[model samples]
Target: MLSFNSVSSRVLQTLNSTFNFTATRHACKITSIHAITSMKTQPNQVNHSVELGNRRKCLLDRPGLFGIKRGMITWFNDNGRQFPATVIEIDSVEVIKHKTEQEFGYTSVMVGAVDKLKNVNNLKLFEQAGVSPKHKLGEFRVRSETGLVPVGAELKADMFAVGQMVDIKGITKGKGFAGVMKRHGFKGLAATHGVSKAHRKQGATGGNQDPGRVLPGKKMAGRMGGRSSTEMNLEVLHADGDAGILVVKGCIPGPNKAYVKITDSVKLYGKSIESIERD
Candidate 1:
């Protein structure tokens, strides 16, 4: 008699072969075996699972690109809490041109925002954008190298949807020269009893013995703000395609008239929120 282990191994092998043969025969019956064979030989053909998985991953890693504008904050209001403000409008963005991998070593679309004829003296750039003139032009990189996105392709608030999260990137408001207490948030010396002029000072920067020199990033008093920053997970309150306006909830960096770039949020808490535009 055959050994028990060998018999079990053979049984498993036979079962696997039988299952595969049954599946192949069933598929062939549904569609002729010629069709199956053709699909197998086709170039760039992939299984449904593989195709679906790749699509899913692409959806998850949605590209976030930058945009620029020179518009005022229109309006804002506090909702009574740590989070304040509702709605911001960054208007019409027209696609000027696209950069290809051959020329730029990457694919990206160049968009023009906030028209200002006085500053934009380049008449050719205006002619290309199909607009009078623009104060700012921005470029955003995408995943693929699909030719120019079509000159004059208008982008509006409709590109994003309400209830979806987004990442807002902008330069923070500049705060000129500042003290350590205001800039680096250092707890200065006590205000009472012999504290003297050292009240706002950064105190002992380094110890006497060890290390001998001050640390590189010692957080001393200096210029503050005016740096690129990102505010994540800001909810889009509304999108008006006709008006080319986007209403985003929560505060954004920068002053009233500062420019900012908005993109789909990299991280989201709930299930992937599909936009109505996709449907």
Candidate 2:
């Protein structure tokens, strides 16, 4: 007569061989023959869990990379939750210069990205920095000189990690001579209350003979967008240093292929609340 423990082990091994369990299902439970047979199996292997590394937190500001907006994509989390992300392509970024507080009254690093083969007017600038001519240049201010990277150092997308928050600055799409309703979200005049040809007007300008002259900062129509704007506290969804791609959650300013400045979030600094794995 076989012992109860031996019979149960035989039954479990037979079940494991017959059924096709997914890695996730097997990891969540005990489906492996070794895991069921051996008492010395590592707990982590039996129940696989992805732990986020806290490597993004920093004490001071650091230089950021310049990237081109490649467009948007959808991402799925480990739990199958969906999220919208904007993909930014990071070119070959190199440190071009360093601005010390003694020389420039502030500590900063100048980085250039997107190599330019020809028509580089400032060849001496690249020569002095010992770097290739780049199409785009950006300056990043740091709290101190310690944050300055050596000149000619190449920066990559891995400077930022998944779950790290960042701030992106870009020029918004230009809308020439927009109306107040479109530009400032004005309610405008009612369509049917005997308001002829002025349905979309800004309604009124100012008071009558009292502190008038159409107040300097009135919400009237003018050239809309096409100005520098910053989106803050956007979480990083993915970063591929080898592929030179950086993806962030939600939409950013400007149209596709437009250059944007990326930096650590001023509000959150370099602290990351959580991390996500690339699918």
Candidate 3:
């Protein structure tokens, strides 16, 4: 006697054999086999439920190696919240030269300013890099040995899109010689204590004979800003190719008209709010 349980098991096994169930780390694909079946079963097909496997992140999901180009400072306002941002005119970042690991010890692309250089800080460096003279120059490494953009290819603001994060590198505005309070954000001396005109002076920066005189890097009055700085994970507010502008949210290093470099944020790229927790 064919019991109902046994009959059902046989039917399931037959159906399983008919349909090819291929499972992978990314997805489950079920390919149906062409087989004649009863009209009732055909119309009322039993749907097989699959608890999908975890999908692996693909190469496309990962942000690729990026390039650097000079940008200018601009302002962006969102809902009355005005923000000073650095806007790069990335309409065209001509690839001046390509360096190889075999010949140059490392792979990199030397890029020059958009137009003829009005002021060049390092003419010898540009000459060695085999690029035309420009106001400024930068190098970005390539991921693969053959990852090279054509020498004359023009890179636009489109390289970085709105909502994407980037690291803005530039020279911070020079404040000249400044007090410790302003330079290192040191709180001024006690308002009512024995402190006199030394209110803004960095307190007691001396060490014992073991360490010798005031520490080499004592936080005393010194030059502030005017140094290379990198603002990381700055979100892109907008990007315009025609205007050659890229608006980033929040402030970046450098004063108005100062040259800046924009590149993919190392820690923030290809990350979502839920996946990323950063201060």
Candidate 4:
């Protein structure tokens, strides 16, 4: 017969071995299950990332929309910093036609905004697109055929997200026949020493007689503004799809009710959504 102490010791050893074996088996099962689940999810995560990247690339490559200038307002960012923002109204923007690379040597889309009487030249195109006549017509070039928008698809201001950078092209306010001092920011001649009524005139355009007559591109008093201008890297502050309003940071070139073309920033083409979120 074994002593009580020895018998108890033997039983405890057996129980400990059994518990260890059970725990080890359960831990292994859990680890294997976790690994299998991770394996199943890994491909999905990769595909999701690829999809986001493609969408971002497509957004960058796609054509832009047309809008009307709606004046400016003060805006505050998340950091409580105030900025002057320009409001743009997008209405009745639709794809008018598509230019194919095979036929046009490059890919682009013709878009129009603001309904108007159908012009004879665009009657056929508008009828085919099933859209009303547009008053403001603009063409935007795309990187590839995939960026072409479907004809007659209406676009809204919501296409631009807050925090996205954009470039606005428009006709600036006209200042008819401005002097050099106002147009080109030229400093007038001294008002004290010996300056007379000619103080406001631009002093001596070209050299004495080297190249003779004023240079072809000489800067002098002339018409100011009213020309096509582009304001680059303007940040989108807000976008309302239903209302078709886009608020952008800083001033845009144009007067109220003037049509403007809004496009993604060419300078920030390399930036992606991830980088924007990081910033």
Best by lDDT: 2
Range of the 10 consecutive residues with the lowest summed lDDT in candidate 4? 21-30
Kindly list the per-residue Cα lDDT of model 3 for residues 65-159, writing each as its tens digit: 22233453556466666656655555345566777666865556767665564666666765664566665557776443555676655567766
lDDT of 4 by residue, 151-180 (tens): 989999999888999999999999899999
Model 2 reaches what TM-score against the true structure? 0.74
Please identify which of the two predictions, 2 or 4, would achieve the higher lDDT against the true structure: 2
What tens-digit string does per-residue lDDT give for candidate 2 at 154-219?
A: 999999989989999999999899999999999999989799999999876988888666878888
Name the weakest run of 10 consecutive residues (lDDT summed) in model 3: 51-60
Candidates 3 and 4 compared: the better one by TM-score is 4
Root-mean-square deviation of each candidate, in angstroms? 14.3, 22.6, 18.1, 18.5
Where model 1 places Cα greater than 4 Å from the true spot, the runs are 1-83, 146-148, 268-279
Stretches off by above 4 angstroms in model 3 are 1-86, 117-133, 208-212, 269-279
* Winner on lDDT (1 vs 2): 2
Using TM-score as the measure, the top candidate is 2
TM-score list, all predictions: 0.64, 0.74, 0.62, 0.73
| Clashes found in each candidate (C-alpha, N, C closer than 3 A) | 0, 0, 1, 0
For model 1, residues 68-110, the per-residue Cα lDDT tens digits are 3333333333563443444555555677777766676555677
